[model samples]
Target: MADDAARYLLGIDVGNTVIKAVLFDLEGRQVGSHAIDGQSTRPEPGHVERDLEELWRNASEAFRRCVADAGIEPGQIVAAGCAGHGNGLYLLDGDDRPLVGIQSLDTRAAALAEELAAEHGAALHAATLQEPWPSQTPVLLSWMRRHRPEVLEQAGTLVMCKDYITFKLTGRKVSDISDMSGAGLLRMPECGYDDELLALYGLQGLGHLLPDLIDPTDVAGTVTAEAAAATGLAEGMPVVGGLFDVIASALGSGVVEAGATSIIAGTWSVNQYVSSEPVIDRDLLMVSAFGPDRFMIMDNSATSASHLEWYVREFVERGGHHDDPFGFCHRRLAEVEPRLDDPYFHPFLYGSRLGAEHRAGFNGVAGWHGEGHLIRAVFEGVVFEHRRHVERLRAAGAVIDHATLSGGGARSEVWAQMLADCLGVPISVADGEETGALGAALSAGVGVGVFAGYEEAVSGMTRIRREFEPDPDMWAHYDHRYSTSRDLAEALQGFWSSQYRDARRENNGEEEAK
Candidate 1:
């Protein structure tokens, strides 16, 4: 039968905490999906890492399970692509063995980041269109060079997360322009590796460690027999150059055209828009390659629905709604409506753009507010943070009349509507639950000639499931809340800085005692 002869595309998404394997047909309908959650170990405060061996094992298991669940022959899956979190350091030793994997959540290079920013911020920005940040690939590499010189001495290749996955699958060391550029390792506009850029970060002689770069839709290599044996895929299947998860989410949400913004409210508040012309501003967080010549101008921070996640993990998980904590959260949020005097919450559990020392808290928690009100405040705080990024985008001359919404926040109708109402823009949620995987599969389709290019692939495969219109009546209310949030954040900067110093002192003291 024709259906039995049909081919499928596989997409793998690697995040800080989850690894997902999703299968999609030529028409972009999901056939089967599986995800595995892996834990990150904190050997030291401010350092977040995952074991390389464990990551590969979990990824392979996810692949096997996904193929089995689809109930299809592995040979029918013609090609695959990967999308992963950007800006972390994944290294291979001189012998090409897994050396270390530092996740993007790490902030071990904070002091170094600040030093680079203060000393050569302008020159660095001119070269890479990004300044030093604690979790940036270059900054983390520089940290390794300074403190852990042995690691750098043994390093043979520096790859992003998806690149590592590609290497495991195809036995090739290669990366895509999107992940490289997003990590600030490539020269902007040109979108190629440059020794001068590395030198700017005091990483002058490490150029050989960088992987070969290719277009996201180009086939990099074929699946190796080793990988096929470890996973349940056919040997010699095509593997496309992969994508940064942010760009994957954008593409999956049908935000390929210039000026269309994509806001992802997951672990990070990722707000970006594709642009034909590159925009460079010191105030902007980053500017990375999107497609062949396009750029994705972005403003992001580790502030988003992760706040609710933390709250649920620490507080709600012990309660009766343990099985479906998020669903319970959504119901609670729906029960509360906005009021002028509602408590203000800051969704900065990890950090913030204001500064790295920033912390999250619920301000003005009056005696009368219940759990529902607090939950609603958490939702509002997350949206307000997104609005902060969107404002920066607009200030940088990116149009934001409307945008696509994806990630955990977009899954909730109430949360999506809140985003629309808070940002005063029409927000559209895409059809699929795993847009990141769909985007990767779309790239795979292009790689294998199942589709001509991204535009055609998106046109054929992606569709909007719901659209949200901003309520003008609620705009004034949200505007007031946003302004207050900004004011409170500014006021708490001094306190956060003090808390950071105390924490450092305590950690140092304990280390000396040991």
Candidate 2:
């Protein structure tokens, strides 16, 4: 007879800050969870890389700890699944050894992104339904072709971060559809590699570098003896190819249904919506791979908790030491009245790639204004930025009646409520903090036939903890502020673009002289 816990599954999520591993039973209850801090190396400006060997070692430790905490033997686990950050590029040599794994935050490929978009023209847009971004694979590949040609020449395969780890574990070089779809190389909606697109980028025959496209619920491969020995997993345990981290978070938040939207509030806040087809708007929004047969259409702002952290570190440094900074910020924000008498703020402290250029400062910081007002301005600024994303989605014909909020920032009731008010929509906090891991597990469950379909797996595993409905009075105030924010953002876009171009030219001239 099979023991109840023997049918357990393991889920691993590789995030920017941490690699979290969770053990779940067949019924979807978390038996145990463990986390390991992930280290990132930035050798130069606009570059971020992770040591592959170090990542594997840390993941192994986390896996062993989670398994031990669950009180389950290695052989007892029936299956495993993995998820990780998306968009970055990973180069593997002929023998499938990782040479480099660049992170999405790295902006070294910006010029290449623009070059490819210009060269490919309509073909690129028709394929991906979105223009190449600095983080896209094609741009990264082009960067490599010019800067690191040797690596590209000797490369046998190219994989994303998650796919590389999956290959290391299962010895299978396959990419799940969701992750592949985000690669700029794959044709969106069709979900396959485009040869002409690759050729246009001077990457002809590079299609061979990509793995077979499998559905997120597909059984990618089984653990081998080497993987079992390294990670303490049972040999032959099935491994499911999970979706990209963003898509997994969406699934784990139970926002898989069409018309549903989710705000992933981590280091960056990504506003995602499920649509029956692709929603591609170059001016304001973008689209990404959501699931095996689904699409995600929305806007992604590269700032969220990172902005909050910056405020706490720079302005409220001492306040963070005495008590929880988030809690303190929340309480302080609550004390400040909603109407600050036409005081405006721009939340682009880091100078957004798509938004306003001003730093976090009040238009009117009079002696009468106190610390509470300053803190409230910060919170209101972030929320207002999110509201702009919501408005962009609405303009793209998306119906975002509600959104599930998931991330470190979502823990604050005050912030969540502020978002609810700013967006004029209900916001639900996700039930689990580890939605990425849960989504990976749910995908595995579907792959292994433990669940009948994606809907069933999601229904059994994901849940919403609480919902925050929009306050009509506060929404009215935010609606007016949002209009002002948009006007300010648009007015400053050209100025930012000119500055960026001038800086790039100066830097290029210096490099040539060197």
Candidate 3:
């Protein structure tokens, strides 16, 4: 009976902060998980990178540990899928060795993207249906050609994070439509690359760099002997083309149909929903979902649970292990109730959705404040951002009937209630924190015939673990605070831009002196 229950699906997520592997049964129960701490190095102030070999080594080790920890044999992993951070360039050599691995959080190409936006801005948006963010493949490749032409000259292919890992596993280079179609590279609504469109972004002659694109649930390939020996996966175990981390999380949360919404408050605050008709507008960003005629509309920012993580790691946590940092932080936040006079934190320690020019810090503070007050403010600020995203979705005519919350922020009861209150809607959360991996695992299931399709797989596997209903009394208080936070951002944007100009001038002076 134990062996009967042991037939499992393995899902791997190569996220920004962690490389995690999770094992789940067909019933959608997580059996075991193992994670390796992932860190991206900042070579320059804006550049975020990882050593490719080091990333592979850590990811493979975590895969091995996950299987071992689950006490399952390698043969039990019938099928597997990968969910990874989207839109970063992972350059591969002709020999299949990694040349460069850039993270989605990278901003090294920001200036180049800005420079070309004038001539190609409309072209980019029309082709990809996405604003060319700094880490889009073309923008990053453009920066490389200018600063390091040799890197582009020797290149064979460009792939995202999960696609690279799939290559390492199966000796095949392929990507799902979900990653490719939205990166300002593929001509969207029509699903191929165009040389004329490539020329618009200075990528005219390098169209061959695009990988073979496939459906997210198609069999990408089977694991190789070399990969099996390293990670304890079966040599012939099938691997499926996977999805963007956000989409995987959406599927894992059972947001498979229209009117179902998902909010992932991980390193980014992602609020999105699947739509039969794509919503193209300024306030929202979109990507192809898993299938044809489907799109995922998202309003996201770097301002989310990472701020909570920063507060705990930098301030509350001691040098060694602390058992419950989140619990401790929640208790501290509980001390300070949500009041009219509380300080407002921008929570933009990372880049902001409000335009990159706006900086993040405490706008209002006083002598009466304490760490608890700051914690409360951070929680409120992150939820306020969630409210902003849902508002954008609503503005685009989304109903948002079922809003599911996932990620680090959902772990906090206090924060979940705050989000519910701020959004004025009842939100549901599922049992597993590894929803991204679980979503991948479900894709694996469909690939190997364990389920019929997403509709069947999601219904069979997912169940709502908890639900938070809005508190009527707190809505007015939060409404006032959220508006104040927005006002503060408007007031501070020009000052932050001026500060940036001053710093850039000082750096230019230093360089010219040399």
Identify the leading candidate in terms of lDDT. Answer: 1
Error of 3 at 285 (Å): 1.8
Can you write out model 2's per-residue Cα lDDT over 108-163, one digit (the tens) per residue? 66667767767775677776776777776777887887777877888888877777
Q: How many residue pairs of model 1 clash at the backbone?
A: 0
Quote the positional error of residue 461 for candidate 1 in Å. Answer: 1.1
Please list the C-alpha lDDT of all candidates, in the order they appear: 0.89, 0.76, 0.83
Q: Alpha-carbon error at 508 in model 2, in Å?
A: 2.2
Q: Which model scores highest in TM-score?
A: 1
Off by over 4 Å in 2: 1-6, 280-285, 290-292, 313-323, 341-374, 509-514
lDDT of candidate model 2 versus the reference? 0.76
Per-residue lDDT tens digits of candidate 3, residues 228-277?
A: 88888889999999988889988998888876899998888999888886
TM-score of 3: 0.95
Ranking 1 against 2 by TM-score, winner:
1
Error of 2 at 412 (Å): 2.0
